[model samples]
Target: MFQLLIVDDEASVVDSLADTLPWHEIGISTVFKAYSGSEALELLKTNTIDIMMTDIRMPGLNGLELLALVRREWKRIKCILLSGHAEFSYAQQAIQHDAHEYLLKPISDGEVLDKVGNLVGILQRERDESRHYERVEKAFQEHLPKLQGDLLADLLQGVKISPERLGQKLESLKIAIPAEGRFALMLFRLEDRFAELDFYSLSLMEYAVVNMAEELFEDDFRLWSCKDLHGYLVFLVTIAGEGDTQQDRQEHPDRAAEPVESRLQSMASQLQLSVDRFLKGSVSVLISRWGSFPLDIKRLYEDILLSMRKQVGNQSGLLIYASDELEQLPVHALQRLYEPPMLVHLLESGDWEKTHDKLTGIWSELGAKWADSQEHLLEAFFSIYASFSSFAHKNGRQLTDMIGPHLSDVTGLTPSRSLEALQQWMFQSLELLQQCMENETRNDRENTVRRIKLFVQKHLVEDVSLQAIADYMYMHPVHVSRIFKLETGENLSDFVLRLKMEQAAFLLADPSLKNYEVALQLGYQNPNYFIKVFKKYYSLTPQEFRQKLEAVEEQ
Candidate 1:
């Protein structure tokens, strides 16, 4: 639908065009009559007029002048020039001003309708095209991140793609880095400070870390990063240009220029300091040697992973350079123990089955590869123990309380004495931990339901929305609703409504209270809506119900 304004020096002409024409049938929802060009401008300022019909002979802002002004300010509004004169000069001026139509006075209504309807069709087509473009742009923006992340992840995992295909993927994902460019890989592992956070909080902190990295590295490098399979943030960075000087060098020109490796190490240290200061979290960074893209990406990733495990094991806030010479190790590091969906995350999320599978994978890897090595055995032992201890402490329990005497002899290394002994202790401890967690979860659910009910009762006369209740309980609204329904077999919304109606019924028992007063006391500002809801529940209006109660008492 559209709105229109009819302007002329004579009021009769304006009223005739507004009233006599079939504007509504041509999709014009509103028609305003203006006696002069100035009046039409005022209406256009206050309203969204889609089509303007004005007389060319009006005094002060003639039709051609008004057309120029409208074209400048509101270019989308279609203008029609109506004049009594049939002179070619007026029509030529109207055409110069980009008027949509030039019609003579005493024109038939059918001709006017035909011209306006054509303009409306054009507007409709333009609107449809604009909306389609907006939707496409929105969808592209929504999926752009995932598309970039997926291609990078596949490349890191050594997914083979021809050079042509990789270039096409890069161009389509709008990645600025060339497929043939040299790049360095940086692996970042969040430390114990972030381990206590839940999955959602952890994801947010990881996003913060990436955003901070982008801000710090953007001037010197083009950075692309993704969360890898092993729960580490992997960054692919390439120097933007040789001309870009480091901030410190720009500040202190006399200082000797540093190599790219030293520059990266300094930047990584700055990132760690920024995260520690701003987000109150520690990050361990491993910087890889620069390598050619596509060909050396997978190897660089593997090298960095090895460097991280061997050089930065069980440590926090450490920055290691993979290119630096370090002592070579004879034994292979256990892969499954630190692989994706690691033991600690599984335990924190209370995924017992996955945790068991992870443990099994670790034990199998140890037996098949390093069975005779006591150091590998101890590595497995300490890793599992750390995960278990972290989970227990997060839940306000001690490791000894959950595993009993098995953990009591940590000094003797009793659990790591043998493969069979470690397996026995590991499974037993897992079973005991699972039982304790399951029992606690059940009790927690009951306690949550009780608290939700108590909160609803206390704030019954205030805002009792799900968001309000969730804020009070310090939980996600969806989680609160799910737990409430799971424990009570009733929807939280239905529970709130039922309690409100019940309280309304009790309040109505007082003969001296007005119906609106009772409604106000129960948080219902609209007495009529309250009466409708009360009638729906009780099969009678509040007034009728109150009268019935009085009748019953008199009887």
Candidate 2:
């Protein structure tokens, strides 16, 4: 439905049109009558007028002038001019002012309905097109992150694409990095503290890290990031523009004095500190040297991975930069041992089969490449030992509890003495650890649910929010919600409401305590709202419920 405004200098003409015309039949739900052009303008300002029919020879602000002003302000409104004369000059002025129809003052109601109906059809078509475009835009925005991530991941993995296709993809994905721009790579590995998180929590932490990077680097660089195949977050960064750099220099004199590499190093250090302080986790950062984009991306990724494996060691929160002058490690640095889906991550995820395969692959590589290198054997031994020990401690146990005293007691070089002995110990320890974890999974969930219930009951009148419960349990709120729902077959929020309502019913049984007093006891600030909730829960108002109780007791 649309709105229509009828204007004329004569009051009778405006009233006749507004009252006698079947405007509703032509989809005009509202017909506004005005005696002068100025009154029509006032109506247009206050209401959304879709079609305007005005007399051409009004006293002030004539029809053509009004049409011109409406054209400037509300371009979508369709205007029709009414005149007593059929002069060509009047028609020419109507056409010049973009009027939809130039009708004589004694025009028929049928003609008016026909013209207004046509304008309504045009408006409906435009509205449909606009809604369709809005939906498409919304869907594209929702999937834009995944689209950008897929393109970046493909480029980093060296998928073959012509420059034209790559450029098209970049433009469509709205990536600001130039196709041939000079860029550098930054690789991040979440340390042991992050690795202990469940898969969902870990993904959220990775997202947080990326968001932090965007904030810290957005001033000087365009950053594109994705989680690579090796379970590491990779950021492809390029300088935004020379203007931005100059502006940054003028804004921060202290930072401007340092070289680009030094500034980046400082920012990376800040990122590490932020993660540790806010997220309660540590991350190891590796920044690669600058190289040409597209051509050097794959090489830089590989170099950074190699550097991380050789230099990161078992340390937590170490930041290293790739430099040409850095010392090269030994030729055989145990590639498969530090490869994607590392043993620790697999164990943390409880993928025992993959963990077993990972161990076998590491031993196979050790035998093929560095059979006689005792240092390599010990390196593998300690790495595997630390992963197992960390997993045990994470579950509130010790390595000795899972693998028995014999293996735990062997201090120095005993376990890594031979390939056969190390393999035996590794397999045996993996079997025992898998058994322990499987047995403990159910018990762990049950215990977590029990603790959550106790905490909610204790703080039933206090904050009992999800975050408060998670803090008390030393868990993420999402993790806590998931665990409670999985074990109890009910949402935590529903459970809390059920408890509150049940307690409200119990308190309502006491006549000495008023409804407001009971609401306060249950942490509800509004007694009326409490009554509404009680009625919703028990199918009766509190007063009625008390009456029923009294009747039952008298009976």
Prediction-by-prediction clash tally: 0, 0
The residue pairs found clashing in candidate 1 are none
TM-score for candidate 2: 0.37
- Candidate 1 residue lDDT tens string, 1-555: 998888886644664566556788999998876665665676677679898988888888888888888998988899999989999999898888889899998887798899899989988988878776887788988998777878888888766588898888888788877656789999999987798999999999998998999999886677898988889999998986644468856764533455677778888999999999999989999988888887888778988988887889997899988953332556466767876677899999888998999899888988888888899899999999888899999989998887786554588898898888888888888999999889989999999999999999999888786657877999866678789999999988779879988998898998789999998998877786677677867889999998898899999
Question: How would you encode candidate 2's per-residue C-alpha lDDT over 1-555 as one tens digit per residue?
Answer: 989888887654664567556778878898876766766776688679888988889898888899999999998898889999989999998888899888885777788788889988887887777776887889998999888988888877766679899889888889877666788898889987788889999999999999998998876667888999878899888865544566666776654556777777888899999989889989999999988868888778778877887888788799999764332545646766776667889999989999999999989988888877888888999999999999999888989999899877667668798787788889999999998887788899999999999989988987676556777999866678889999999978678879988898899899999999998999877676677667867889989998999999999
| Top-scoring candidate (TM-score) | 1
Q: TM-score per candidate, in order?
A: 0.45, 0.37
Report the Cα lDDT for candidate 2: 0.83
Once fitted onto the true fold, the runs of candidate 2 whose alpha carbons sit more than 4 angstroms away are 1-335, 344-353, 363-383, 386-398, 411-421, 434-452, 467-483, 510-517, 543-555
Runs of candidate 1 exceeding 4 Å displacement: 1-330, 458-486, 505-526, 543-555
For model 1 the local lDDT of residue 476 reads 63
